[model samples]
Target: MTSTADIGLGTAELTKIFTTATRIKVCDEKFRSLILTGQVSAQYYSPRGQEIVSASMGAALRESDYMVTTYRGLHDQLAKGVPLRELWAEFFGRATGTCKGKGGPMHITHPASGLMVTTGIVGSGLPIANGLALASQLQGTDRVTVVNFGDGATNIGAFHEACNLAALWKLPVVFLCHNNRYAEHTSFEDGTSVDRVADRAAAYKMRGVRVDGNDPVAMHTAAREAVARARAGEGPTLLEAMTFRFFGHQMSDQNEYMKPGELESERANDPVLRFRAALIEQRVLTEPEIEAIEAQAKSDVKDAFEFAEASPLPELSELLTDVYEEV
Candidate 1:
């Protein structure tokens, strides 16, 4: 475990990361439970093992900085400070959701929190992030834009195009790839040509880094440096966060494609649990404090669930509304 001090992260920051990750973990668990029991039904993609990656990356940005993420972005949304109630409401398709229940889980958007878009299409958010960064540049603000995607998105053409444009224009953007070692059911080795996704950054003349996404300290350090460089008008960075998903690609997937013992190994090294232990070991957080955090997360999730259940669904008229501007 890297010392938080060595990474320039104090106790407060570490606590925030742990708290965010815990909330995400708890939220994911609750969501899965809801689905299993038929309480809520939606196309869900579990971000179970990628909690620390989003938490640490989110810790590096300011509230005003922009972020774009993929459908598997509950962690990103939560880490970016989206209210638990609103997120749950959106997931539940309640009228009070961020998108007024029109977007559902895959399209959550909250501009107030700088979580601008949750795209369902793979590799689509990269160019959108570039647009946001270009806007910030034109407005003469230091606000950076971070786009989160899975390793599979890198194989798409948009990834290369966005990277080239971002580099050529020196856009203040960060291309964060959550490399969970699998693209849906396809293993990384079977799909990708490169040994490391970060290596592709060289082709576009951008800085690249590959770090242990499960390690809070290392993940935060890499994210912070990338964010700082972007804020200082440096070109974009390609950060490959190495991680693994404990669950299958989706809720129904049994991970039949994964080799035997792989899932078990990753689960045994669960990032959330590891981070919790590290916090206690480093004295950054006592066991009581950690328990308190976990308790609070559960309380928040419960409240959010209740709020979503109580809220009404969108009106039938809403189908016609928000479809087009009345110019």
Candidate 2:
């Protein structure tokens, strides 16, 4: 068991995770601004308060490792090192985007960084991750696949079926459930039968662990172990990262359904800010250094947004360019 002593992370590594969370937060905040100003008119699921889990998990992954996430996956992509300019252009529907402006925010797939799949369907990513892991197994490789989903998606049939198969085959995949309390406006209590989503892992004879996804130390520990187990061909593990979203299900959502004081209470625990404060508290990083990192994040986001705005839109002829078969 990894001790609580920084989880075997040095000052540099811990700083990387903190900066990653900050970058994801800043990028999403910029998107929220663009969405409000009507400059970017596209549907998006914001990862507002849930940046830490993606940062911790993405930091743990090797460049060869695969990941599958949902429509709200800006945190995942940015932490995995997706170029900001391309991502911003995609959201703006420009030709320079990741999918050449076709995939948008919901269907981003950058395989060069091992982000193999970005499925918008709830719970569908689980089975798809299994398939990717299966391919790695057949090829005699140890590349692990991390499938990320929300708490509400656990109720879907594919989540269970994939978990069962991965366990039976000892496939190298990690089922990471980002339990942000509410699954698209519905609370987990109203959606799930079990208390913690990790508890479901026992049903498939796999190890189950739950932790504060907001805390860098705890999240990194669980992620490291789960990833290692998969690399060793020990089958899958379910890691339920308990977190809260600072915004609505989407940027346009009014979030009238959120319980009173819920959003307000979670403000004190926003992972992005919390991690930065933690680094300072632990004497690993000074406040000025943290501020500099945050400033850089905002600068990068600004540059990307400017580039996207200045870029050319897809040509009219491109309508049939990426298309394969006529419908």
Best-fitting candidate, measured by TM-score?
A: 1
Model 2 quality (TM-score)? 0.96
After TM-score superposition, what is the CA distance of residue 317 in candidate 1 from its true location, in Å? 1.5
How accurate locally, in lDDT, is each candidate?
A: 0.95, 0.88
Task: Give candidate 1 misplaced runs (Cα > 4 Å).
Answer: none
Return the number of clashes found in candidate 2: 0
Decoy 1 TM-score against native:
0.99
Tens digit of lDDT per residue, candidate 1, span 277-315? 888888899999999999999999999999999999999
TM-score of each: 0.99, 0.96
Residue pairs with backbone overlap in model 1:
none
Per-residue C-alpha lDDT of model 2 across residues 17-115, encoded as one tens digit per residue:
888888998898888887899877889898988888999898899999999999989999887778899989988888998888888889888888888
The per-prediction tally of clashing pairs is 0, 0
Of the candidates shown, which would achieve the greatest lDDT relative to the real structure?
1
Error of 1 at 208 (Å): 0.7
